[model samples]
Target: MSLAVNPRFIPPAASTFVFDPDLVAEGRRESVPRYGDPIWSVLALTQNPSAPDDCIRWHWFSGTFRETFRFAAWTLVNHPLADQELARHGIAMRAKLSAGRIMRTVHQWSIFAAWLDERGITRLADLDTEGLADFAFYLAKTRGLSRNTASGHLTGLSRLHYYGRSFLPPSDRLVEPPWVAEGMDDYLPAASPLGGENSTEPITPATMGPLLVWALRFVEDYAEDILAAHDERRRLLNAADAADGPLLPDSGDALEAFLEGLEAEGLPVPVAARRGNPLAGAGIYLAAVTGTPRSKVRQVMRKPHWRTYTAQNHGPCHLGTPVNATLDAEPWHEPFTFDGIDKMVRHLATACFIVLSYLTGMRSGEILGLASGCCPDPEGPPAEAGRHLIYGRVFKIATDEYGNHDSAGVVREAPWVAVPQVVTSVRVLERLGGDGLLFAAEVHDKRQPERRSGRSLQLSTLNERIERFIEWVNTHAENRERESEMIPQDTHGRIGAGRFRRTLAWHIARRPGGLVALAVQYGHMRTLVSEGYGSRSRGGIHDLLDFETARSVAEHLSEVHEAIQDGEGISGPAARRLIHSAAQEHHRFGGIITSVRQARSLLADPNLNVFENKDTFLFCNYDRAKALCHPGRSGKYEAPSLDRCKLNCANIARTDTHARQLREAADSLVRQASSGLAPEPLADRMQERAQGLSELADQHDRKRVLAGMEGHL
Candidate 1:
């Protein structure tokens, strides 16, 4: 009583026949009349499976018929089925339909097989041409398949279907479906093996071998020792936790990795400490000091506590305690060097500046503030050979109340005062005659005075020139092709003015080697970073003595007498009295005692070294050397009168020797750099310079010859 139909049905687009209701009814009627049977009832079930059993219905008993019916009319028209005879069988039902399901699955398979069918397609091969054609339509239109997909399906199905078809009889008569056209291939992107931004370019050994050797031998070996020491430090700290600070950059391996990482990130591996200072002792101390970043220790500490100037065999002196206050460079501008410079105007200024800066290290404003009268002849010839020989007893230069220059263009002048060092630098200028502007200030407006006005160059202008010189020297030294790589950017990637002072301090305090060695080391270090200047570690040590602690000690002494009975065996004041009394007979004890008392009381508590105490006492009437005229004035340390010195002062001899050595070292560095390059790399540049020199020589010869010829004529 129930009607069962195949569960699967294809969309109408896959049908071979474009069925019209009217044509189907007429066909059915004709078929029933000829057969003289109730074919309509059975045929009705084929037309409608849902039809009432009492009336007519359509039902597709065959999966092939159902699948073929799903395709669009257009697809059916193009792929006409060879199994058209199956429709005349009143649609196969039940037992016959079960066979049709196999036929349908085969039909789907045949469409794929048709691609490889060649001309020998057949029915016993399991599907006829019509079934294959119908299945092709079913796949394309019913399944919404694009030609590529259809082609791919066909290729895959052909492997299995064609192999099966090979066993069939050739008389089966299967016709292939028409070929489906395809478009260009789809673009399939390749998967990247290593994702993100990474370099594909390999690091070749030719370029990397030398770098490797430097790291392994120089850096790694040194670093291993540093690590061993660090381990020792940790053990010590664990024993006495209060002594050491937190570990820095952790271990040697960590430090190494940090350096490599920075280099990889395009930064130079900063040296932990420079050479001359032998960072071992100080570096270990600094590495253990807490409360600040390592880079900043120099600024706070003032580096070397005592400067050991051996020229005169007095001990060391505290750095901040000025040896000669009048000789301070603050009043003058920074000096410029002209040794290798050849530019006309720049060289002229540089020459003047070198004389001034080497002698004074002045601020530019102070140097330019000098008047003609500032360089009056010394009462006698200089006792020394330097810029210090020039007299600077005129008005001391200073910015007006506004300080420096203001937007209003008013530059107020201050009173003149003697700058002891200025006297020496001015001698070089005085040789040119003090007639013109010493350092002509560049400005525009009606306020301008005559050309020789006592005007000085603006500080900014002088700084610009200094920067230019630095650039030129660095460029020549580096042979750099790009400017950006010459100086490093800060952490935030910025450049600034602090570079010069820092570089100078580093050279004086840290870096390794003698002058030549330092220069060579600098060259190599800079080359590694592509910067033009010498690479030096800017590490420092703080002065050991503290003014506050000294003051506390002095203050504590005053109250100690109150804590003990007057008859106490050894009172603090009694000890002081004993020392002072003993000093009366012993010269060394005298100076030391006096200095200690002064440091304990009225005088500013100084970080006194032996030379400093000696100098202090010599200045204050003790005159242990019997050299000073008055207590601590010019007369105390001044040169002898010109008539007395006769240009033969021993001080002048020492000064000249030092100056000559310094200049020679600088020149040697230049020469060493000239020889550093390989012959091949420099051949062309050398030839070009030679050729230019030869042409000039030839021109000069021609001129001389012409002059002789004219005279003969």
Candidate 2:
């Protein structure tokens, strides 16, 4: 019923059945597949700029099309587009075809579109290979395009030219780009200027500033709501005028005022203190000054004595205020642990630094500059007496590798802050060692040039001795039960040096009753003194115990004994009450109580350590006024000798009374057994008294005889 008219001549590559104009038009409505999809490649090139005049098929293929399209759009919106310009024509064509999605990654395409808009060339048929080459030169020499990137644009253009002409007959003079001209192969290099792998662009610091600014702006405007609410920020801006000077200063009076204002207004500190550097520094400084996690500051305010919260995480003393419901309301991830550090490849100094860090929570740079004579033993043998002291400072040092060897390395004296455990641990490392770099220092080897610059431990001739130490610890822990407890189990592989310091902080914050007893003790004492106890004391208690000193003594006790004894008949709560009452009466007590019940309560309530007196009695242990006893009096407590013990043993239990009592008991038992006067009230019948009890009396006699056989047998 239909009559067929001769169709227009279709290329051989075209399907046998002529494509219906309606169908082709409808097909264009379908989404162009993503550039990454193979189907996008099948679409006919739609706009080649290098085609000769009157070449219809050549007009279809487009080179540098997508990138140019976006460029054209951007240029049109930002820069005026002129009629008859080649860039304008290209841009207009792109707007009709791709809409906009193709422009995302295609940066170079816009340059060409701008070129066309400026040149007044409306059609691809109007341009020739020479014209395209002129544009390429414009992009490179004039537009400041890198030579390699310009070459990439050239490659895409050439591909379009080749494919565009394929749609035309041989006689059609659709001139090709210079690079693709036949019999001129020698003129074209094997690869485009940007084709090689070496042409890849690298990000430099110079370029990063703009990106960083843009990203920061984007984050501020969109992702993070830090700058969203203006009322709170206005308050901070008003306060910022007051907070000038050093980045972080000891007295945060102005900062405290700002924070207090925010708290008074019932806003979160993080939310209220979010204005500028001083505010940021407030969060960080509070962490260092108070020794709590940056994440826990909110919880500190709710305590009954808010001012005393500084001692909560720093040690176990109660802060005056109740830690607010807000802080307790939030859940935080469990802090990092250091169970697998022995597997890390680190320098001995670095490892020692790691240990020092875990034991002391010192900053990395601070730990590095520790002096050799820091921990001197006051009472040991003259040659071995660096063991008497357990205190030091950490400083900053600079090292140079150049001709100025005279001033190559310099050390500075830092503020001296004493931590009993740190002092003891450092002394242990020193007494057992020799050192080059106290912490790992990056070194340059004068050996093979390529391998010349690397880091090494000077103490060991080759390799990091820390690795060996960690491996030994790991292996020993795996084989021994006692060591296993100290080592953290790592389902994930390897350990980092930073984790040690963090873990130390975590345990102090989380395990105040067990591992952090000493830290808790000292932190409490320091807080009390620093808070001006004399001024605040109700009874004019001038002989207040120095929190730091008391803490140090407690720390020494904890190091000597890992755990408080169980089955002590005293409940954790009861123990806390007893200790708190004692501390109140003595006015010189500072120690942590490590009872299981108290520890559980501490963990369950984050506010426990965030406020004063929350854990006052809970973490207290040692008696600064009397001799230190092992928890539970499990065994006879031994007096630590000045030459051997590193603890503050000034007030140890006197052994005279206990020794006399034990000697008398032994004599009484010996006499009763030896004289056959031991009473057996259970039975009236008497078997001949066994000599076993009599033999025990003889053994006791022999031991007594041996004990008195001193100096001259």
Candidate 3:
């Protein structure tokens, strides 16, 4: 029971006393860790018996350590003392530290060991406060690590001193914790001013808009053709598998008849895209068409009649079922041939990923973690008409009922609210035919069955796939001469999985039309939409929303300040107050808000009542007493209901830009009235509306005040 026994007493290969003996007793004997084991598979020691082996396994430092550094450093990490200390630390704080955290600790220990070996300090007892200080300096100055990252390295070393007392002998244990006197902060570089800013850039609207449009085209329009080709390929493979015996007596005749049928219908013989030799292409395609094995088809192709037929039709053929989806009133793509079916299916899956990730605002991992039935069709009438939900496990910040870090992750109690598009994407993924994860690694390739670990597609691989999807879409658009519809290259670089949720939050927070689109198109209530996204503790979509909202407000204020400086005029009850406050804040902040806190403080100023209402033709310089948008609502903070703006509201503000937009609206109404398609009464109403909008614009031009006239106003 005592783990404090001298290390010299036990052989190197002996089992370590790190695991809970009671749990080890119940587990298979082979799963136990030995001191000399090069890689320790330790999931058996944890309560999560079903966790993946890679998640729990600890590989002792070997390959790169041995190749790059001295053998002594490699031995230092592989040493029995190092093993005991880390094992003790892992077991003692298993509740707080996850399997991934334990792995990170081991990595930090290896780095520390390498630093010790370089300095020829063979034993921990030889290390003192001065040596620890040198190591801290090495990490910051030599390694060029950021303050936070250096602190992480120092934290691991400090834990060694804390945990080593119980596991290491007195001579091997450190005399004191690392940075005990001055704290780790003193030894590290000063934190950067932009250190805590969220570095993940949201995808710009130009890029995301076209990307989602094409993804919808794939999911809603072209899915049937891709999936049909997928089904046909699967059926052919199944038939080939079942026909293991020798070829049928009439197999050659059947293939001949099929070729004749193709000729009679004036359809070209189906051939693989890149296959050069006619006989080879014929063998492959005829086998698929005739439900015969490729080997059997090759044998039959040796006949003189078939050789003549293939010679006449040597080029690649597009002879599959044509899909009904169209682009610009024409077919979007050619018929789905067998040669490119696999590629189309992979693209279809990627399209589903894009739709699901962009629309639902689910993290990449959560989307990939989805199973076949995660978003099944609702059963009851009430549920059928209700919101669709996707049920999946969340790994980040996931915990078991006992409040322990669960490496296996926990099923999310509140599922992600899915729009109709997301629901369709899930259904398409289900039809693609993968078990367990919807985006399983083996879904695209089944040749390497040995490598099938039932894990979801990796983030790096998915990123590459996204790039390919973009290239394919651009190519397709170019071929159709629709250059205007191509997805623009994002200035932020490649569109990775992490960008989707951030971009969704940015759109929801900054774009009022975006909110209405989500409500009308996606059937989402604003409250439930935010709640669904913010339910995951680690998602931070709500924080992103807050930051984006604040940033938008700051930008709005900056624009107003610039407009006023340019001698623009404004008219409204609150216009004079708005101009004065904007001028004051601009002077106070130098018109540059650098941080979220500064932005939030700017938004809190009651005198700066400039609220953006871009969808409408005016800004709301809101005063609750004169507000007509929300009459009876009272709270610590309130927002103007821009959707219900009244024409005569006192809070309405109009600058030159708003007046121009009003004139444009009037022109549009006049054009609609003269279109000749409307009834006489409706046309008259439209003309009246146009006249009213024109009068409003004329009134704004008459009463608008120039800058520096606030005192007279």
Candidate 4:
């Protein structure tokens, strides 16, 4: 026998539920949500302070499901008993969950509720093992979601059960677990062995080179003219807005005076291109030249002489804002045409985005969240001569002032180190007005004043803008007959903001002393420290570096194997060891790395120290005891200093390619010595150096072994 409680005496869960103490203390009362509110505002709980209000709000349910599960959803997130039960099941309680995680939970629960409603089962107690199995099958088969995604939905349902059983009335409680006999794994698809590779593809060299070159050109060269035109257009628009009522009585006389001045100077009215033909708009051109309101210019254009002047002087006009940028000694762009200033400004902003994203390697959200003056010029510049830093918030691993998961992110202690190009890009963006954010949503569409929203630009919108930039680049290249300079389509389909960081990692890892590597090495030492600290974990850029390094190692080994097969001999002290190790690795790993762990493990092999030194025209088959690059250094060296490679180092290895490059260098030196331009002493030194290089090449040719002829060497 059970005691019956009166329904009238029971209090609503919303009235009794308590908010987190920290949140209540920190947040404004009006911003904080009551448990019973239809939309729970979690803006104060977000890690990104720049995140829009809509992004943090949790709208429980929409459409028909709202009426069916409104009370149930409220209880699941608010009731203390439900929260305690969820904590027991190893799920985070409402107060601990981040805004993003709570939103995902709500979305998943809504899907399940809608599915249950379709089957005419409304209450949690009505759900059973058979219905759960059918739902799993529907997620896996009908919906066709990936195994990981479907598993997430199932996990959400399991949490729902833990909370549902703690309901006030026993009739609404679920007595048994949702997955009675089987778990979520049993319903998921089989996992793949090679599944840990990052999905974001690196931008190929073909695309990245031209893309960056053009972006820099826009930022450094075309920026001045574009800004000038933008200002001129804005001034005209302001004048138009401020002029009240009708045209002034002197407006027609002013317009006629401007036309007379142009005629006297033998200058045609300013014409813009329209459908391959030059056409002049009297009102707009007169307004621009005479500094009058365009609204008044329209009234002046209605006069008879205005039509006669435009018809007689209708021709292409060369007048515009003067620009200093040039290509191949010719002006890169025609003088800025004020009529097309808006398009130019949009393209300028896109160019800045490309430069900042690719060069700095900041995550898209962090880059988009940048405010004005984030990277200010130094005041006196005495502390560090060349250190340029960008100060901004990092949301990925941020915490609040009280050491909790903060929705509003904290300022990063170590600012991002920027290159000169990145600094220039930021300065250019500053000139383009946004409320505070560098990439505000309304920055690109300033012509539409009514649409100003002061929100950070969305990633999806940036993706579209990137596509337009590419199209404009291709068209410009085609017009100039420089087809090779056009940015080609990447194999990874459309390039998005997320791929830049991975691409930067790939370039830095594979090309040790190339341009990108040098920039990263000097500008971002903090990244190196983070990489070292997180090397053991699957975080930071180190994992990407490992993957790319492993790939480079595998390709080198495969090339060595093929050279041995082709009867090409390797010459060095470690040649025999290199041959043996290369053959073993080729057979064992099959020239493929499946995951980051596998790449790290493969790179840990000490016997496989084949370092490609393209700058020195040889491979360093490095043995620390035998290396001469680190002169007078202590016990053991981790890697050969290829930049300081000695010509006579025992660790050096020479192949046919190395031999060819050596011969070419020797011949070039000989030519320089015989040219008679050098001093006598310098000429003698050049000849001696040439002789030594020729001997090394000859020695390699004589000592190289064929396949199965190691005994002779």
Highest TM-score against the true fold, candidate? 3
lDDT of each prediction vs. the true structure?
0.29, 0.33, 0.67, 0.67
Model 1 misses residue 94 by how many Å?
99
Q: What is the C-alpha RMSD of each candidate to the true structure, in Å?
A: 45.3, 33.3, 6.1, 6.8
* lDDT head-to-head 2 vs 3, winner: 3
Q: After superposition, how far is residue 106 of candidate 4 from its true place, in Å?
A: 4.9
Over 1-713, each residue of candidate 4 has an lDDT whose tens digit, in order, gives 11222243232455422244354434233455555566665544454534545322234444545533444444444443344554455543333445666567667877787787788876666777777878888888898877767877876666556555544344455544445334557777555444433556788978887887888889988888888877877776565455434566775566678777877887676666666645435355556567667777766655677557666775553335677778778777776665677778888988898888777667777888788899977666668665567888777666555344565566766666677788988888888864478877666655422213454666776788888888999998899888988999988889887777778766765666445522334214334424332334422455776777677777787787778888777776556666766787688676777678778777788666677777666777777878898786567456566667887787777777678888999999999999999999999999998998888889888877655765655
Q: For candidate 1, write residues 226-263 as lDDT tens digits.
A: 22333444443343344334445532333334334544
Residue 25 deviation, candidate 2, in Å?
77
Residues 1-713, model 3: lDDT tens digits = 32323444222323454343454434244555555445555444333322334322233334433222222212223333344544544423322455545556667767776787777777777888888888889988999988878887787666566545544445556656546545667788777544443456888878888888888889988999788777876776666566546766765666677778877776666666454554455455566567766777777667786567666765554545667777778888877766677878878888899888777777777777778899866667974566777888777657667565665667877888777888889999888855567876667556423323455666766788889999999999998888888889999999998788777766766664435232233214344566586554454355565566666666676777899889888887767867876677677665565566665676677666566777676777777777887767466325566666787788877788888888898899889889998899999999998898888789889889888787777
Ranking by lDDT: 3, 4, 2, 1
TM of each candidate vs. truth: 0.21, 0.23, 0.78, 0.76
Tens-place lDDT digits, model 2, residues 223-252: 112212222333333444333334433344
lDDT accuracy of residue 285 in candidate 4: 54
lDDT of 4: 0.67
Once fitted onto the true fold, the runs of candidate 2 whose alpha carbons sit more than 4 angstroms away are 1-351, 377-421, 428-436, 439-471, 477-486, 491-493, 517-713
The better candidate by lDDT, 2 or 4, is 4
